[model samples]
Target: MTDATLDRIAGALAGMVLGDALGVPGELWPREKVRSRFGRIEEFLDGPADNIVACYFKAGHYTDDSAQAFVVLEALLKAGTVPPAKTLADDLLEWVRSMNGFEINLLGPSSKASLLAWSKGEDAEAVTKLSLTNGAAMRIAPVGCLVEANEHEKLAETVARVSRVTHSTDVAISGAAMVAQAVASAVAGRSWDEIRTDIAAIHPIALVKGEPTWAASVLARLEAFEAMVEKLGDAPSEEDVSLLIYRAIGTGTMTSESVAAALAVALWCRDPWLAAVMCANMGGDTDTMGAMACAICGAKCGISGMDESVVKYLETTNGIDFRALAKRILEARANFTIGD
Candidate 1:
């Protein structure tokens, strides 16, 4: 409710949009190709003519990552809080149908397959159980920032509810929960150390059946991220960071790689813009990783920390009101927590 808190919330949302747009041009490019094409990706650039997915969208345009996150935001606003599973599922089903018919852009495989199953009258939980991508994590920022700073428990609960709509696997939910908890802690003004602890401590829900094997797989990546960040030390050169992220940590869209990559970048960089830039340079799944890393860093830095020109360009090109959406989410959180 305080001005500082609002600033952090707005900054986090702005960071997602900025990261999404900035990472567009390099989405599926290899690190070498990205460097060869754009040098360092410090600003917005158009998608290359050859990329089928990226070419459909323009410079400064966000793909499914931001679009899906905005759906989560709209759902939250409509419910005035986190909606129940069926309600959220219906909203997502509608999104899937709408996008499938009218594809100016494309949807991620994890989300598309899951929603398609649901549309065919398959069990919702069964449909989601097959998803193990970072799709859920990419759209979870709003949930993380939709609660009071100290409501870490509520944050996790809301994450589970929304995640189950599309990502029911334990590993997918766990990755999403980690990001959400970090966002909640950051918006509450927690230090990086505290935020890391909060994220590391979260436990994934079973959600009917669990994916312990997958969960362990993702946990190994998370552990590797911690070890890599510690080994490289803070403020490593951009080239060093990019190499580690691409070669060792990886930049895939799977929850295991992308979640760990994003968290690693976030842990290594204190500045929001720097984190986004580093993720962008690392290439593959750049938009999702960039969005994830920057959301956490932006929560720490606040809106004032972002470059004015980049933020202005995102606003002008994307036509999104990040600050207004942030304010509404904060207000909804206040309403939900009034009795707590």
Candidate 2:
């Protein structure tokens, strides 16, 4: 990989960590509670808070989002690309089965469901029918990076293969595909407008078409997503911008509303720091949103786009050196040919 490519990967990885850490503190707070408690979320504050991170004195510790992302990264490294559905399912199940000690912290709800089914001797294809959670989208960002510059078909297939092992709902698969495609576009240096437009075109069938249930809500909220994207155009104040989007959109549910809210934070930020902080503070499902936002901004700006404070905090708290992880992934990529 070229130095620039490595730098971009590093930035994105760091952005993921930064976002995970930032969002950890406000994971389940309602919008009003978040606003009342934090008074407009900006920067990592040390104190009691509803989010998991506040339980620790340090900053930057990651939750299931970043940890599962690393699992996806590991799978990509070993498989040499996005594996096919059966292969992906087997690999993920094997990984989960091998978990011992500290590795237990990484599995999520959808993954847990799949693992339990597998343990009970269920078929992989049949097991996936049990879940409809955000677990698929949460870990699939690495697929975006792994298949950089690929078209929507390739991206969608990769996401679907990985997702169907656990998250088979159209909403989960579509959300994963959208995130992967968006990250891939960003990595290819596409403009944000282009990324959004491309995502809209890629998933026309999956966009909301009916009442606002979890499955249909992401599509139903398109107008609100577009509005937030528009508001982010002027480079508004980070605090004001985050609140505006949070109030206008919201960060609840596993649907598109949450994804759009996270994307709004990334789109509005002048840098990865602001993106991570803003997404983290939106409360419910904060870590997942933060991680997704980090992936988007990090792909666009590279590691230099992040704040030193954020990087330091993540390393100290999470015991994960995101920059090193990026370098390792780049090295792995260099050793394999495109079709290998």
Task: Pick the lDDT winner.
Answer: 1
Instruction: Name the lDDT of candidate 2.
Output: 0.66
- Against the hidden true structure, what lDDT does model 1 obtain? 0.77
**How close to the true structure is residue 271 of candidate 1, measured as C-alpha lDDT?**
75
Best by the TM-score measure? 1
TM-score of 2: 0.80
lDDT, candidate 2, residue 284?
Answer: 76
**Looking at candidate 2, what is the lDDT of residue 6?**
67
Task: Give TM per candidate.
Answer: 0.91, 0.80
Candidate 2 weakest ten by summed lDDT: 205-214
Residue pairs clashing in model 2 are 23-280, 25-51, 208-219
Report residue 287 deviation for candidate 1 (angstroms): 0.3
Which runs in model 2 stand beyond 4 Å of their true positions? 40-58, 83-109, 123-127, 204-214, 217-220, 228-244, 331-340
Q: On residues 202-294, what C-alpha lDDT tens digit does candidate 2 reach at each position? A: 565432321123455444455576666566676556566666766767676564556666666666563677677677666677778888878
